[model samples]
Target: MEKILVVDDDLGIQKQLKWSFAGYEVIFAEDRASAIAQLRRFEPKVVTLDLGLPPDPANATEGMATLEEILELAPQTKVIVVTGNNDKKNALRAINLGAYDFYQKPIDSDTIQILVSRAMNLFNLEMENRHLAAVAPSMDKIIGQSESILAASRKAERIAQTDISTLLLGESGTGKEVFARSIHEHSLRKDKAFVAINCASIPENLLESELFGYEKGAFTGANKTTPGKIETAQNGTLFLDEIGDMPIGLQAKMLRFLQERVIERVGGRSEIPVDIRVICATHRDIPGMVAEQTFREDLYYRIGEISILIPPLRERNNDVVLLARTFLAQYNEEFKTKIKGFSEGAIKAMSQHKWPGNIRELQNKLKSAVIMAEGTHIQAEDLNLTFNNDALSIDTLNLREVREHAESRAIRNAYQIAERNMSRTAELLGVTRPTLYSLIDKYHMDDIKTG
Candidate 1:
C-alpha cells in the first residue's frame, strides 16, 4: 500500500486526516523535527505539510523552513504545503522553493483528498518517465554498433542539440528515419511532436495539400477546413522523408517556407506562421540528381546544413550478426518461442550474404524464422541458407581454426564498439594494451582504421 506522511501541529486536524484517507497508510508528526524523522524512516512518496508548526502557527517562517529542509533531504518526495485562506504569497513562495504544490485550507475531506491523489499520480508518472529515459538506447534505438554506424551516430548526436536543418543521406533500409528521430529526441523540441511525411509515398496531386492546409470548400473533397502536417507540427520537428522524390514544381514553395517560417494554404492567401525544426532524409543520390537538373540545387542547399551518411549493412563487418541476434530476441518474445540463438553455419551464411535491403530485410527474415523454427535452436536451413557441408565441414572440425576465428572477430568487434579507444578495447578484450597490440599485429589487420 502507498504511504502518506502528514506533518501538522493541530491534533484535531491530524485525527481528521487519519480518518479521511482510507486507502493510504497515513503517518503523522506534529513538529518539523518529528516530521523529518518520520520522513527518513518511512520514506513516504507523498507528504502533506501544514505551514503552522510550533513557534510560528501565526506566521509561515517555521513551516517554510521545514519545507525547504524536507526537499533538501529527499528531492524526489512530493511535498504539498497547506496554508491559510489568504496566504497566497507564502503558497507561491513555497512553490519557488521546490515544493510540489500548495493548497489553501479549511481542509474539506473531498477537495484536499482529490488534490493529494493527483499529486501522488503525478509523482508516480514522473518516476516512470525517468526510469524509461535512463534505459532508453541512444541513436534513436537503432541496434548496430559497428564502426561505420557508430561514426554516423556520433556525428548525428553531436549536431542534435541545435536546431540545424539536418539531412540524412543513406541507401534504402539503412535506418534514416531512426537517425532522424534521434536528432529530434535529443533536441529542445523533444516534448513536441516528431511529425513525418513521405514525399514519395503520396501522389504528386495530393502531396501539396498534405503538406499545406486548405480552407473549407477549397475543392470537391474539402468539405471541412483542414490543417496540414506542417501546421500540426508546431514548435516540434517536421521530418520530410524521401525529399529527393518531391515534385520539382513544389520545391519552390518548400524553399520559401524554409526561408520564412510561414506557409500559404492551397487555396488561401493568408500566410500562417509555424515554429519547427526541419529534418530531411532520402535514399536517392540527391547531389547527383542536382547535377542532372532533376532536383533543385537551391532546395538541396537549404536542407543540407548538417548531412550524415549512414553506411549500408555489407560494409559494416560483424554488424549483420549483431543485428540478426537482436532481431531474433525481439521476435522470440513476440512469437512466444524459446529459440536460443543462431547456429555456427547460420551465422557464417548471414555474415557473407549481401544485405541489399539492409536491416529491414534482416528483421523480416528473423521474424519468419522464429515462427517457422521447430527446435529450441534455429538452424541454417530455417533461414534458407544452404549449408555447404563438404566445403565448410573441415574448417568447423579444426579446433585451432575455430578458436582463432572467434578471437579475431571478438577483438575487431570490441575495437569498433569502443570507437578505437585503445584502453577501452583492451579492457573489453580482457588483455593488456601491449597484448592487444601484439594480437592486432599477429592477425595482420593493422591496415584497418581504428579511429
Candidate 2:
C-alpha cells in the first residue's frame, strides 16, 4: 500500500484531507518535529505538506525546515506543498527546495487528490523504470562513463554484431565477463544461452573433457556420457574465460573447433558438429605465451580475430568514484541499509589509489564497507585501503612515478587481502584469476606468501 503523510496545524483541514484520501494509509503530523518523525518512520512515497506548522504557524520557516528535512531524508520522495492564498513566493521556494508540486489553500479535496495521485503515479513509474533498467542488458551495467571505458564499450558494441570470434584482453577484475555478456546480449544471439567457463580452473588433464565432454568410460572416473561446455553452448555463445591457462594440447583442439565448428567427445570416435559463437578472454600476453610455446599459435590467431582490451581501473580517471557509488547503491538495496553514500575521504582515497585489482576489488571492498559501516556514510577507513596514507603523502616525484607507486601498493594490498590466493585475489581485485597470476608475474610478487 502507498503511504502518504499530510502535515498541517489545522485539524479540520487534516480531517477533511484524511477522509478525502481514504484509499491511502494517511499519516498526520501537526508540527515539524512530529512531521519529521512520521517521515522517518513511514517513509511515505508521497507527502502533502502544509507550510503552517507549530512554533511558526504564521510563518513558513518551520514548514520549509520540514521540507528540507524530508528531501534530505528521502530525496526520491515526492512532496506536494499546501500553501495559503497569495503565497506564490513561498510555493516557488518550496519547489526550488525540491517539492514535487504546490497547491493554494481553501483545500479543494478533488484538486489536491489529483495532484497527490499524479505524484504517486510518477514516483511509481520512476521506481519501476529504475528496476527494469537494472535488469535490462545495457551499457549501464558496465558502471563507468570514463573516457577509456566508454571508448572500449563503443568498440565492444560494434564487435558484438559480428559473428567472428572476439577476444577480450584485459587484466583481471576489469569486467571481462560483463563485456562478454554485453556482447552476447547485444548480438543476434541475445535469446540464446551465454555459457562461461574458466579455462584455468579446470585441471590440465581434465580440462579437455570439461570443454568437449566425454563418452561413457572415457576415463577411469568417466562412467556416463556427458556433454562438454562447448556442446552445451550450442546455438549460443561460449565465453572461454582465462583462455591463456588452457593447456597447449587442448588449444589445438579448441582451434579446430573454431575452424571446423565440430568436436569429438573423449573416447568417442563420432564427430559432433556444434554451432556457437566463441568469445574468449585472457589477461596473459598471448604473444609471449606463443613465443614461449605455452599457448597454441593457431588458437591465438583464431580467437584474436577481434580483440577488445579493457583498461585497468586506475587508468580510467574518475571511474573509481563512479563505480564506488554504483556499488554502494547496489549493496544498500541488498542489505536494506540506509547508507546515503561514500564520504569525501572515501571518494578521495578511491580516486587516488591505483585500482590494481580493478572493478572486482572495488565491489568487494564496498560490500564490506557497507556492511561494517556504523554510520549512514561510508568512510575511507571502512574500505581498509592500504594506499590511504600514500594518497595523503605530499612527497612525490614525477606523476608517472607516483602513479606507478600507487599501483604497486594497491596490487600488494589486494594480494595480501586475498591471502595470495590468486583466484580469490583476482576476485577481490576485480580481475580474472589468470590476470591476477599474470600481475603476480609482472610485479614479481610470487615470493609473497598467501596471508
Alpha-carbon RMSD of each model: 22.0, 17.2
In candidate 2, what are the lDDT values of residues 332-430, reduced to their tens digit?
Answer: 889987666665456667878787888888999999999998754676778886435455446656664465456556777887787767667667778
Candidate 2 segments exceeding 4 Å error:
1-138, 386-451
lDDT of each: 0.82, 0.81
- The lDDT of model 2 is 0.81
Off by over 4 Å in 1: 1-137, 387-451
C-alpha TM-score for every candidate: 0.58, 0.62
**Per-residue alpha-carbon lDDT of candidate 1 for residues 158-212, written as tens digits (9 for 90 to 100):** 8887889989998999989989888899888999999999999999999999999
Q: What is the lDDT of residue 280 in candidate 1?
A: 98
How far out, in Å, is residue 244 in model 1? 0.5
- Candidate topping lDDT: 1
